[model samples]
Target: MIGPRERVPQAGRRGTRMAEHTGPGRSAVVIGGGLAGMLAVTALRGHFDVVTVVERDRYPADRTFRKGVPQARHLHILLSGGQRALERLLPGTVAALTEAGARRLYLPRDLLTRTPTGWQRRFDERRHPTLSVTRPVLDAVVRERALGAAAGPATRVEVLEATEAVGLTGDARRVTGVTVRARNGDRGAASRVLPADLVVDASGRGSRTPQWYAELGREAPQEVTVDSGLAYATRMYRPTARGEAPDAGVNVPGWPECPRGAAYVPVEDGNWLLTLSGVRGHHPPTDEAEFTAFSATIGDPYVHELLARAEPVSPVHGFRDTCNRRRHYERPGGVPDGFLVLGDANCTFNPVYGQGMSVAALGAVALRDTLDAAGGPGPGVLARAQRAVGRAAEPAWIAAVGADRPYVRGGGAKAGLGERLTTWYLDRLTARAAVDRVVGAAFRDVFCLTAPPSRLMAPRVVLRTVLLPRRPGLPRPPTAVEPA
Candidate 1:
């Protein structure tokens, strides 16, 4: 229960007295203790005296399942772009994950991917690196490092587990803090407010920032949702040894022609994380028999063949909330001072693309950069930070939304002439990449987020795309034994 002294009046409405923190603050409160929340706290530590992360679930002592992050059961790969951002933010995060048994894969070279167009030919020396680890291992290592950094001099970082934020405590003009309640729901569960000079909502896809805004008497940020109706079912397996093992990683793309896709990724402990997926009416089933059959429906059958006899470490896990949901938090005057949103809360992409955590890391970098340029945390700084974060996520959003629009239901914005032309061009480029190293290198850069989408539009790439005849694709997955 909150003491009477702790309760403060909301900032009220626009015409009323506002509670704007015109300068840097002593404390900040971050809602959600997931990756985004922890990184948010890290971003604020240099600018604030104290920071606190509130999470609804108790922190697991080991890398095991927790109620909060149900989607951890699926496959996740850290793109090189995300790796660079996180390494910059937390320094040596990439090495740490590698040391934890994560597979450090070089793109295309180590991957036996089957793109929608065809099999992607491997190169000998591409440097686009990706990390594959179980979600629990990734999250635990990040948590440990962030908490350790907080314990250092100059700032205080704390965590309050089993606490759920119920509402915002301020008005439309400016946000002051968050109102919260214990998750245990004990009989004496009186609510309390966590005061702050700034508040960040990094609560993932289930975020309540909109409701909190409405409670503050402000208009909710406009939203855009493009759901492809994709459902994913993943199972963990202690893969077979040596010559019989599947490729390091594989992805069968999903499009209208074949709405089913699957991926086999190597994760911690030499176990393989395989996910079977189907879109719209073809959602994958969780039953073991049905799951195996669904894998066969994908463009390729190698994933199915690999999993048909694997020993299971866990039952099939399903996640269905795959949508490109972006809240327009950067709209002029639409966002309140001292309030900002990032991570999946601000924009959630179709998880099939594995962009959520990576985008979150990029958003934290954007937040840190914006705050540093603004000199510190204050009223206008959060607004600017929100806009910058949105920009940071824009590229990934464009890639996911554009790629997914064709598979989504309902009336979405029709593809413009430019979009249709670009799609046609990319189809050829992907085909050309099957045998051309130059095209493959450029494609890998953009796909891995190391380069912008505009990289594909460069004059040299454009000339090659238009002039070079695409070589016929390999007849099958490029997993044949490499020459000695």
Candidate 2:
């Protein structure tokens, strides 16, 4: 918990080392300059003397999309758990984001959310308040803070834009640095190795750590991917008056019968981001006419009605290939010392769950605790840190994979008894939650990641779900919130 204005450590160049890092002289190299990379920089404040963040794309001014991140145009909102974790790392970050036009919202109350079971009932007050903003805007604000530009003294982190990590520099036992290339096609400039005490492959979901490890004579980490084949079609629109549904966000989650989903999120600048999504063979279309029609395939058409009135600002954008990918770095022979991976590099969730960014923030916070426990960054601590990061991500992973497991199996691989029982209980919980305020609030806590999924399985919750008769599904979207 260093002050905002503290003299941040400035690490100097330290080359290759076979032995583990001892006392001080702490330094680190973070590959990838996205939200995870920035937060990692912030977390390394007290522990490292020098930290370098190497990004492949040159960042633009403000919250504009960078070249490397194709999903920046998609709708992104920070879950409550992530927001709190971020604020803990960099104070005033939440205020900075809100000042930049990101709105904080209540979970089921502020949004018209139709879950797998039914519509979520709104309440006058709730604890889970999530932050809404475009991916680019969120990245920019966090980058500014992590780079020492947001009210903090000159930080230890140095940004090397237009740079990419090509390979690990050390041997199989331990990693000491990384080989990098400037994205600029300078044939004359040869590839160079940047030395460091530690290296982080936060290079994202497409990270080549497996290949790099293979080249270093180490076994590749076990990779688990559950591809539900979910596709996203997003289009930006001018804000339209709520009229009947006075909600800040609208979500219709897809279920088996209605295999389609849709969401409308209020981003900065009075704009709206509406996305239509589906799984496997039932992907949403990008055509204007078909996109609107796809909305009907979902549970409700309220989102379509609202979009019909709003003016289109951006063309329809489609993103496919969203799969839940989890690399088992915690397994033996999975990770090397003095090197670790976080964020999408370690685990990539199905974006439809909206847990990626939140998990990333949580992983960063967990990294801080791991570093403190290890008493500084070094070879001895790298594996433990990776395990801790994986632990922090476990809850989100379970929620996402559990929900998506049924979809991908396509009537073949049936969900185990545990999953079946869990789903049945949750579905009942959702039905009762629509009419019950306390139940709704508790559900919102798990949805927003403010609490663990185990809360839904509590004796009280289970008993209520089992004893109470199911409430009638809302005849329509819960457009108007009744004052409680």
Candidate 3:
């Protein structure tokens, strides 16, 4: 357990009180050891002398599953914004992903997508790139990069595996540290408090920090949610030795009226990661034949076609807990000093948008940028961090929930005049993007988080949306290729 005596400065500083806490000049403790936790530690390293990452599971050295992360079996892709932020955190991180067999795919051109409007035309090239890799491989690479960077000459990143954070240790003024329980080989448990100047909760969707805040005499934060009732089923397939395999994966889009969607992405080891998903009543099945039959119903047949040539490596895996959830940390009365939430703890997306990892990376970048401006961690740090997480995640929440509402149950929002007008303009923009490469690229940029939603409102793009030639909606597959 870490205590006040363990708070000595690393190499660069000489201090007594300065080494005691992260505020002004001190150390930080981050709860959770997944990608978000590791990223948060990397971000806090420069400002804090000692950074500790605590997790309930023992982190593995390879690309394998552990108790805490269940989403590893499904399909996940990181957008360009996430890649760029991670690269900045650990200089050669992207290169490391490539070395570990991640597929670095160019947008639109490499993506064969069937949108509700029609088959999207492939563009020539792109300024932004998205990454395709299994969840475990991606997590492992990020953990390695961040943990390495956190161990720099003047900073320290300590990992406490097989440990769980019980609650916050401070009162209303600020969070001093976290109380944790560690399990030994003898099945014995020991509890203690690890003091710090700053504490970050990156414990993901199951976080109990709200209760901790209430314990400290603070009100709970406000929250908003759009539960689309999304469910996902995934299967992995390896390439056959007899035929040459293509590098690109296929996507079959859902109907504006229906809720089903499918995507096949190529990842490491010459394997294809396929996911079939639906909302509410149209949920995909787990049976092998039924799963394949469901894939045939997508707008694009390419996913079904590819399944014919590939062989399944694993049984179908499914998840149904995806919901668009957000906590309004920026609002008044609740937020405390020395403590902040990052990644899924602050906001969780529908996941179909593939924004979770990227948003986490953006959150880490925001934390770093905020720290740089403020000089060091202090009373206002958590507030500023809340703003940063909000800025990083709000656009994604809007974009995902915006498109998703028309199809899911209770899709309509508090339909004010401004909301109605904005929705109308966005619908027109989506219709135009079906045929225009320039418009498509711009739209893809926003989807990938390389740019903001306001970029679509620029005069050039707005003119294109207003006076552009209309085209048929996205195309359906030529024929329904029944999966084998």
Every candidate's lDDT:
0.78, 0.77, 0.77
Residue-level lDDT of model 3, residues 1-484, one tens digit each, is 1112223222222222222333344778889888889889888877888877778777564567776888889999988988988887778989888888898887666667776677766665566677899988888877766765665655766777777898898887677899988744535567789998888999998888888888877767787777778899999888776564555667765756656899888898888888999988888898988998999876666777777788889899888988888888866544678888899988888888899989999998898888878877756766887788788897888787676665556543454564456667777787777667767767888888889988888888889998977776546532321111
Cα distance off (Å), candidate 2, residue 339: 0.6
Q: What is the clash tally of candidate 1?
A: 0
Best by TM-score: 1
Ranking of candidates on lDDT, top first: 1, 2, 3
Give the per-residue lDDT of model 1 (tens digit) for 111-173: 777766677676664467888998888887777676666554556666777888889888889
Measured with C-alpha atoms, the lDDT of residue 163 in candidate 1 is 84
Looking at candidate 1, the ten consecutive residues that score lowest on lDDT are 8-17
RMSD after Cα superposition, model 3: 6.0
lDDT of 1: 0.78
Candidate 2 residue-wise lDDT at 359 = 87
Per-residue lDDT, model 2, residue 397, is 80
| Candidate with the larger TM-score of 2 and 3 | 2
Q: Supply the TM-score for candidate 2.
A: 0.90
Q: Regarding lDDT, does 1 or 3 come out ahead? A: 1
